[model samples]
Target: MTRTELQTLPERAVELLGGEPDDTTLRRYLHGLAGVDAVGLGQRAADLGTRSIKTTSKAWALDRIIELIDLTTLEGADTPGKVRSLVAKALNPDASDPTCPRVAAVCVYGDMVPHAVAALGAAHGDPDDGGVSVAAVATAFPSGRASLAIKLADTAEAVAAGADEIDMVIDRGAFLAGRYGQVFDQIAQVKQACRRADGSYASLKVILETGELTTYDNVKRASWLAILAGGDFIKTSTGKVQPAATLPVTLLMLEVVRDWHAATGEKIGVKPAGGIRTSKDAIKYLVTVAETVGEEWLQPHLFRFGASSLLNDVLLQRQKLRTGHYTGADYVTID
Candidate 1:
């Protein structure tokens, strides 16, 4: 579609949910989506994975992967020092190569937003403008088992602290229990809370934690649900789950985003967090995104990799391409 036809929503606009957000409406819409053919989906993903790239294309893919990384540090022991180091790495992912592109954002816990923002300083802003964004995980990330009041407070605190993006986890319990409306309301409320004082809202990435969702059909439904609720992105995991971000699950989510764009003339982002630690694996995802959605979704705003070690591997690959020789594991910084 042309740029004029793309129905981009204002950051603070009402949700894309056209109908009443009641449970009945949610159930019907969700269940009404075409069922996923597991065998076919998996086979497609595997088939795409086998499509190799030329040396020049591999070099391009390596850099593109770097730009898509959400240089993340989320842990109980996380501190200002750690965040600063992460920001440093983000600013210059490859210290030896000044031409190396910056990462899309530095993802941290909500409490660390201030530190991340401070460290990013003048470099903190829109990814499109060559500035790295600060993404804070809120809404009781990973577990998402908190009261609505606390969750809103969490989001508000992050936005107040200069977070450019908010990665919120959906109430998977509610979703799995058939309370789709509750999940929808929570996402919508979180999106509202992401609004800043000036009225612009922080980008909201709704994490589905697909590993726990149990079925590909549920992943597709969750993707649509997140988009309808006004999520700027639909993420695959919190990076805490065991089966985080498999190729098939991400492919399913991308298909949903593509269908949504086709029907509504709007675009939504997708992220596959965790377990994607190699350039080869990441390229498979890139191939899938290109074939399923379109090459336009490759931008940082439209796609992301929620990972830590993934960067190290990409860096190593990049170095190898530059020098035409193998790089040892010690070549890249430890995450």
Candidate 2:
């Protein structure tokens, strides 16, 4: 929660697990996690959605949303030209205004990693250093339906091409079929695959794809499983599925990160991707984060929004905040 007091983490995970994460022990630790109260969880998220941060604070939240965004473009038709355009937008969301903060990263398909890095050039590095990062979706991306060899290769290729982050979808089928160990093992191996030749590793954001998780309990278990398996961030979706991201699911994952910090002092990140289209929607999530995990968890490394069109809306609202009047949708570039 209080990330201001948090230490800089290793380039890779330094063993947050207890004992070997074999099937039996992994299952025992996951199942030992407290069950979610569906009604209470839903109600709590609803309540946070109503808290207001108007005027100046709202302006601050809008820009913070921009900084936290992964500025994503994960379409099947993604090309090098389109990735360069996305990289430009990440570098300067509002070309008219020099003060607009750049996004945290330009998330693209694995094949687009090279194009993104090349487009970014000197402007690509750690987001904390005022440089945008390039996050590539790997491990078979939205489906997680590939062989482990394919998945590892997918991850390795992205890192090899200079991806700073890897967003991997978990095997929902394996988890749903009660193969917890398999899911855990795949994530662990993917984590290993994220290692670059220089020995530094890409940050792994495990996409739980909660739409298929089917229950709050499963989301909770998956959150802990991802963290224990060394996910730097527990993301809600691949944005290809229905019901991609929701406040309640994000809240539940935030609770896991919060509790995990209390237990191990490890600050795991939580990302709620998809369907978060407007500054209004993004502000609700910001409020949720500040309340659940403490305001300090609101950072480029600790939180991120996987989005494409969300940036268009935030840019519009930011114009309204500065000019005291709304701009036409045409003023904001559509992703």
Candidate 3:
């Protein structure tokens, strides 16, 4: 509960993961392995790993960020082509994706979930289709800004309609007014509502709308509170605000994820939404993960980006590499 207690792994660290090896065993194995450090790894990640003199190489930070993109930025039924484009970009963030890691997920407003799901489903049928998931923004996003009854119904609809995951924004007005219990209770209830009688439910990501919270301390508190209240992922914004997601805010949240994972042995995810538009920006996020939460959180289930525009640039860079011609223009414009 205290800082020192949180910094240390839980008493049942090994037991936290049922039937898994203890932390001591993990430490000993890494200590004995070559080029491995049980303790020094996270402490040593470099910024961009030294900027390339060639100016042609993608920043190591960007490469990592590309790997974690959720690529949602999608809306409307007519925008499936845009989704397809984003997928292409993600698949080829560099050189036609000769060896690029996949994007974390593809996010969309809830109404578009059926379309997004159908697109991915079609892709799955093709042997060459690259797989990415659909994350739906639910519970009256950009405004948590609504009644709890309406919010719950909204979340239930999204999950039932084929949303692999749901990103719900919290009511910042309540949080800022020091109504912590109200904020926390709403999140917990919404998370429960997302579940079905079949015991299946979309992953619930609670968006704190960090910009609205307006303070680093508040961000940290919100992150902790969200994790405590059963948020599978704590996101930064709705991408509708002027100062949606930012590096500093993300850094604070990432630290919270690290601390939460250490204390409760629960790996709550982090998502930075809004204003991220380039592969370079994306990479910085990867650096944050490697440095703050270690390499394991880099997976799609644990990390995500909510940008629609960033995907095109990532794809353009890839196309340039493959055809030896870098003339492709921007593929998406913000709506």
Q: List per-candidate RMSD values in Å.
A: 4.4, 4.8, 10.6
TM-score of each: 0.92, 0.91, 0.72
TM-score of 2: 0.91
- Residue 283, candidate 2: C-alpha displacement in angstroms: 0.1
lDDT on C-alpha atoms for all candidate structures: 0.86, 0.86, 0.65
Over the stretch 36-130, how does candidate 2's per-residue lDDT look in tens digits?
99999999999988765433365678789999999999887888999999999999999999999999999999899999999999999999889
Question: In candidate 2, which residue ranges exceed 4 Å CA deviation?
Answer: 1-19, 53-56, 326-335
> Which of candidates 1 and 2 reaches a greater TM-score?
1
Where is model 1 more than 4 Å wrong at Cα?
1-18, 52-56, 326-335
lDDT (10s digit) by residue, model 3, range 17-60: 33223334433422332332313433333332222212223433
Clashing pairs in 3: 61-283, 62-283, 70-105, 72-107
lDDT minimum window of 10 residues, candidate 3: 326-335
